[model samples]
Target: MRAFLRFKNSLSLAFVAFFATTSLVSSEIADFTAFDVNLTLALLRKDQKIEVVVRDQVTDGCWTKSNAAKTAVEKNLIIAGYENIVPADDNAFFTIEVSALGYDTGGNNCAVYVSLRAISGEADRYYMNDHEVMAINLREQFSSSTLLTGPKSDMTSRINDTLYEKSDELIVAINAARNSLRKKISDTTISEQKKNGLLSAFSLD
Candidate 1:
């Protein structure tokens, strides 16, 4: 009987040790969503007449992604020194939509798909569409045998990280697409004075 009790105690200690290690790993991942919006905005320049709109369907109940798009637009305006441009949406020559495609979970992984589309004019189709996929490496915390049985807290943290990564990608894609629009506007045959005025206002020089 004493030997059996000793064996049970050993199992209990091992279980505790395993969970403690898991908690430590989870803390190391950090929360990516906490810093993504501000970081992305800092990296983008306000050098174009582009408006940012985060689709409601994508950002619904997702504050991190929503703030990312919102902050990017605000930062772009600030960087261009055009904060005075009221009703930016109406005056903007181009609109960029940041949308969330969907989420995928299986195969020991969590994946999120994000898309960006640029549109101009009432009849003009989207001039650019870009997609980015962000994923969390679940293998580090889960194995095939225990994939679906991991701690909920760990899984939630991983998903947050993926969402944040995807938001950052959207920011980069929008900036690049907006640059393309800028080049297209510059190449047009508009009058020099009008072109220069628009360009200067947008800080596109």
Candidate 2:
């Protein structure tokens, strides 16, 4: 009887540990493809206006040596008309970090990976941190090239093309994440009055 009880306790402990680890992983690297923009926007409709700031430190790796990631962020954000506010704004805001950007030209040919994080608010009031990763491959274009041999210019061209192709997708992810954060703030920290005040102050009402 004692042996069975010990076994049960061990299993319970292992299950708890497994669940904790799974939750941590899920919170750390959420894929943007799974984002629900409509739901998040609905949740944020009445909340405070938010600001955006882009991080300068773009992730560097094999394919990122050419500033492809940074260029993509600048181009896409500009196209989307996203305004980067200063510190004096005093409203709810989020900073975008380009956490990962790289390419792999091995095994099955070419692959591009991009990761972004949206860190909401500032200081103690800060509440939400969301992350998303997008990875794509060019098997159709590079499957025949076993050596992956290409000039720097050619690689740059391919990288730019891929980044442009995924630019709209990245914008969608950012929009979804921003709305999700607004929803979180609405549900948890800020009061209705504060939200209304913020909206009024920003002339968004």
Candidate 3:
């Protein structure tokens, strides 16, 4: 009977240790959104640098041990910036908190909040997302000749512009020139030979 009791105790110890390790790996706390992180990165100028403060929220019903997981996440972010921007999603580190019970079980999911603050007022939420940023290594999206537009602001090249390219101005101009030539033909009262001469002068051929 004593040996059976000792074996049971050992099993319980193994179970507890496994539960603790799993909690350490899975528990996360985050309160920032991806919109905020992307906006902040966009505001960075060619040589300018900005600091971001990422934090997660704690729910009243959170388990006491979840705090350690939050700390681990914070340490990782502080040491290494979210360097990769081409993540499957923008909100990679953000965490969502849900009310769950028991030690080995976690809740459904949680939402994260992310924020960026430029030390100087020169940067705002709009500037972060709307303006070009230099800190991130963004991959260029591929475009075909049919698409025409490349990701460039200056349209000095034959390649189409990223924003606006291949406007219908050429078509409109051609139509206007044709109409003017037709009007000249109608206004002429010369003989057919003279009319043909005038048409040739107009370069309608």
Candidate 4:
């Protein structure tokens, strides 16, 4: 009986240790992903232009539906110093596409899901021995959901607000990453010219 009890306790302890290690690994992976995303966002420049596209997928009579979500997204992008263009301009630096779905859950209650993707207008190409090679563009996406209980007349307004909030969040993240990169460049021991070059490379100046 004593042996069996000891073995059981040991097995339980092993399971706990395994779960703890797994949790730690997951946390590390999340941190690495966030860092990678921030580095990518730091490459955006204020002077660059971005194309905006929006899709609405809400179908309900209770909600006042219109082009409010798209307008909100465009407004936020313009506020962030990005020129919003349509029809996918080849000269644009990025294309921001947004999709929004909403649900009216009876009596002034609603839920919305919004997703945004920023795709690089230019592709990264690999060349070998002056021969044509492969090229791929970068895409980053984020999503958010919100639930609100308000007057029926305010449904459209609330949806627009959510869209604006998500767009602003993305811009804020990019700015934060850009500022961090600039600060890192400034703190380095490199010469002023080299520092400026680095900043320019990252579109920080």
Best by the TM-score measure: 4
Expressed as tens digits, the lDDT of each residue in 1-205 for candidate 2 is: 2332343344334324433433321331121111232222222222323333332222223353435555565566666765443242554333334433334455434444433443443111123465443222111100111122333335445554544445455466546555664454344344577555533432334
RMSD of each: 26.5, 16.8, 33.3, 16.6
Error of 4 at 80 (Å): 2.9
Over 80-156, each residue of candidate 1 has an lDDT whose tens digit, in order, gives 45353234445443455545433324444333344444443211113345644432221111011111222332443
Of 1 and 3, the candidate ahead on lDDT is 1
Per TM-score, what order, best first?
4, 2, 1, 3
| TM, every model | 0.32, 0.34, 0.19, 0.64
Q: What is the Å distance of residue 172 in model 4 from its true position?
A: 1.3
Tens digits of per-residue lDDT, candidate 4, 1-205, equal: 2332343344334324433433322233222222233444665556555677777776564345546667778878777787645555445546676666777777756666656667653333467999867444445634455555555567677666776787887888778877876786566565687667656655567
Q: Between the candidate structures 1 and 2, which one is better when assessed by TM-score?
A: 2
Runs in model 1 lying further than 4 Å from the true structure: 1-50, 56-65, 82-91, 104-109, 122-205
Runs in model 2 deviating more than 4 A are: 1-65, 83-94, 99-108, 125-167, 173-203
**Which is superior by TM-score, 2 or 4?**
4
Q: Record all residue pairs in model 2 with backbone atoms less than 3 Å apart, i.e. clashing.
A: none
For candidate 1, give the lDDT: 0.39
Ranking by lDDT: 4, 1, 2, 3
